[model samples]
Target: MSYQDIRSTFKLISGGLSETIDDSPKEFVSASITDTRLMGVVSMCVHWRLPENSHLTDLHQFFYFDAEESGFETYRSVLGNGGPSEVQEINDIEDYLMGGLGGKRVILTEREVRYMLQSYVDLNLRSGLSLPEDKDEYEFMLSPRVRLTDSEEYVLMCKQCPGLDSPYQVINYFLMRCVGKDFGAAKFLTKGYVRTNLFPNHKGATLLRNVIEDSPDAVSGSNTDYHVTDDDKDFGTFNTFKSYMCESLIEYSGKFFLLITQITLDHLKIVKYEKISEFQVSAAEASMMTSRPEFITVTDLVPSAPEFDRHTTKLTSKSMVTDYENGQLFMIFQPHNDHVKNATYLLNDDVLGVYYLLEDNQLILASYNLSDIRRMELDLAESSMAPYIVPVSKYEFKDPVLFDFINSSFDDFEDFVATITKPPAE
Candidate 1:
C-alpha cells in the first residue's frame, strides 16, 4: 500500500465514516460517525501538509505503516526548487511538507488524530502478539458481523460503545446519524444547533468583556426575546467540531432557517419564553389532565407513560409530527394524518433510506410511497430545551394563579426542582 492510495481510501470514505463497507467480503467494521472522525483527516492529509507535533510522530508512522503494509500507498512530495532549502531536524519533515511541499487540506489536530491511531494500536496489542500484523489479511479474516454498521441510536446509547472506540468512531457515529436524521430534520422546520468547547486563550477576551456587561453578572437573563436578538460574543466562537458537522447539516437542510441557537445552550433554552426571543415557537395545544409522565419515552421515567411494548408513533390528537429523518414532506403529512394508524417507518442511517412499512401489511421496504404507516418517533431524541420539543402545553401554563402556586409554593428553588422532578403525577 502506498501513501497516496491509503490516503485515497481514507478520503473516499471520510464523509460517511459510520457506513458499512466490504473492506473485505467477510470482515465487517462497526464504524460510527462519532468514532470515525480520525478517518476524515486521515483521508485529507494523505496528500496534504500536516502541522508538526513531536509526540504524535510515532503514532503517525503507525498509521502510515498500517496503510502501506495493508495494500495502501504514499509518495514523498517532490519539493519545488528555489524554496527555502533549509532542513535537517527531527521536525524538518513536517516543515518541508507545510512549506508547499504538499498542498493544504482540512487540518486534523495531532492529539485527536493520534487518539484514533493509538486506539487501533492498543486494540491490536490487547489481542496479543499473535494478532495479524498484516493489514489486508486482518480484514480478510474478521467476523462478518464486524463489517456491518451498528444502528445510530444504539451506537450513541453505547456511551462507551466498544465497537467504535476511537476518534474515528466518535466522528463517524455522530456525523452519519446527523446526516440521516438530525441534519435532515433541520432541513424543513424547527431550530437546531451545534455546541462545542472553549479554548483557554479565549478566557482573557471573555474576562475583558465581562468587565463591560456592567451587571455583576456579565451574562444575564437565561431566556428572553432580547438575548436571541442581541448579537453578542457571549455565545462563544464556532470551533472545528461545529465547522465540520454543522456545515454538512446546514447544506442538507434545504436552507430553511430562522433564529439559530448556535451561540449558547443557555441562550437557546429560553428561545420559547416570550421575554426571550423575537423568533416565536409554535404555541402549545389544548393539553388536558390525561397524565404528565407521558412526555418521557422511558415508561420507567413517569410510570404513567406506556412501557416499551414496541416502538410506535402514537401521538395525542394535538401533537405536530415528522418522520424519523425529519424530511419536510414526511413532517408536513402529520398535521392531517393519524400516524399510529399509518404504515410504520424507521430511520436506518446504517442504510441509505427510511425503512418503510407497506399498506395493509407488514412488508418492510425502504421508501415512502404506497405504505400504510403504523408508528412514529420510535427512536427520535429531543431535548426539553430543543426549540421543536414542546415541554409544557399552554393550557397548563395559562392559569396565572395555578402557575404561580406551582412556582412560588415550592418554597425555595431547590424545592421547586424536586417538585417538578418528582413522579409525573406529582
Candidate 2:
C-alpha cells in the first residue's frame, strides 16, 4: 500500500481503539497491517513516542527512509506497528534516516552535526569548563540520544558525529544553524564600516608639535611615522585593572615627564608640537585632577558663640591662627539667637559662607563669598558681648559635635569633604 493508505489505516485503527477504550484511563493499543512493494522497500524505521493528551491519547510517530527516495517520509502511529508483516528491507537502513521522529522534526546532516558539536565545545571552553572537573558528567549531560533500527549503526553514527556527544552542540546546532551563516555574511559585509567608523583617530603628530613649541626644552625626539607594536596596544585601558594608558615620545625627567595621550574612553583630544606632543586623551582623568580640590581638616577651630559667654571654649590655640594664614581651616559662625539655636556658619578660606541642611537630605551650599572673615571679626567686636544669655545648656563642643555640623551643612561625608576642600577658582 501507499504511504497515505498506510496512514489512513492507522487513523481508522486509532479511532476504533479510542471508541473501545471510551474515557477510561487505561491505554488502548491499535495495530494495522499493509502489503505493497513500496512498504517492502522501507530501509529504516524510527519510532518516537510523543506526549499523550486527553484529545489524542498515546501518540507515536514512525519515520521511514527508503534508499531509492531522495526525501525521507514519516507517518503518525497511534497505538502499534502500522506496516507490512513480511518486509525484508532492513540492510544498511541506518544510513538513510536523516530526519528525526516525533512532532519535532530535527533533520541534520553528518557535517552539520559535527559543526554543531564543535561549536558546543567552543562555547563550553569559553564558559571556563575544565576537563579535570567531571568531564564524563558534562559529556553525558550534553550528548544527544538517537533512536534507529540498528543499535550498532546508531552507535557508529554517534561516534562519527562527535558534536552529537554534546547536548550543547545538539541544541546550538538547531538554534544557530541558520542564523550563524547570516551573522557571518553580515560581518563580512560590514567589516569596512566597523574599521572606518568604530575606531577614533589620534592626532599624535599635531599634539607633539604643540608641546615642542610650548616648551622647547621638553622636545627630545621626533617620529613622524611611529608604528605601535601589538604589545604596545592598551587593551586593558577600559578595564578596572588600569585607569589610563598613554604612549608618548617625551622622555621622563626625575620630577616631570610630558605625557601625550593617543586614545581614551571619553574623547580623542591629541596635542602635538613639531617633535614635542602631549595629548589629554582622557577627559575623565583631566577633570578629576583639575576639578577635585584638596581640603584640610581643622579639628582645633572653635565653633562661633556669643562673645560675652567667656565660659564658652576660647580659641587660644595658635595652630588655629596658623590655619587661617595658610587658608585651610573651615570655621563655623553661630549668631546669637534664641529661636534657632541649631543654625551654623562656615568659612571657605577668607570668604564667609552660610550653609543649612534641608529636610530632603540635601546639604545646600548657599550665600557664600557674601561677607569676608575680616569684616565679620570687626562686626563681632563692635556688637554687645553681654546679652541676656541662656542658662547652662546641654551643649558640649567636641569632635563628635563635628558630625552634627557636617550633617547640618552637607548631605553626607563625601559631600562635606568635597565642599570644604574645593580649591579656589583659577
TM-score, every prediction: 0.17, 0.16
Clashes of each: 51, 19
Give the top-scoring candidate (TM-score).
1
Tens digit per residue, CA lDDT, model 2, 1-426:
111111222211111223422233433132111111111112122222223443443422233322112112232223333333212121112211211110112343333333333333554455554322223212322335433345544443333222223222222221111111222211212111211111123211111111111122321223222233354357532221111222222111111123432211111111111222433334334222222122222211122333322112121110111111112221232221111111110111211222222223222222122233234333333445213222221112222222234335443444555555589999
- RMSD list, candidates in order: 23.8, 32.1
- Give candidate 2 regions above 4 Å deviation: 1-120, 123-138, 144-426
- The Cα local distance difference test for each model comes to 0.22, 0.25
- Cα error of candidate 1 at position 46, Å: 10
Per-residue lDDT of candidate 1, residues 57-111 (tens digit): 1111112212112212221221111133412221233332222111123333333
**How big is the positional error of residue 335 in model 1, measured in Å on the Cα after superposition?**
49
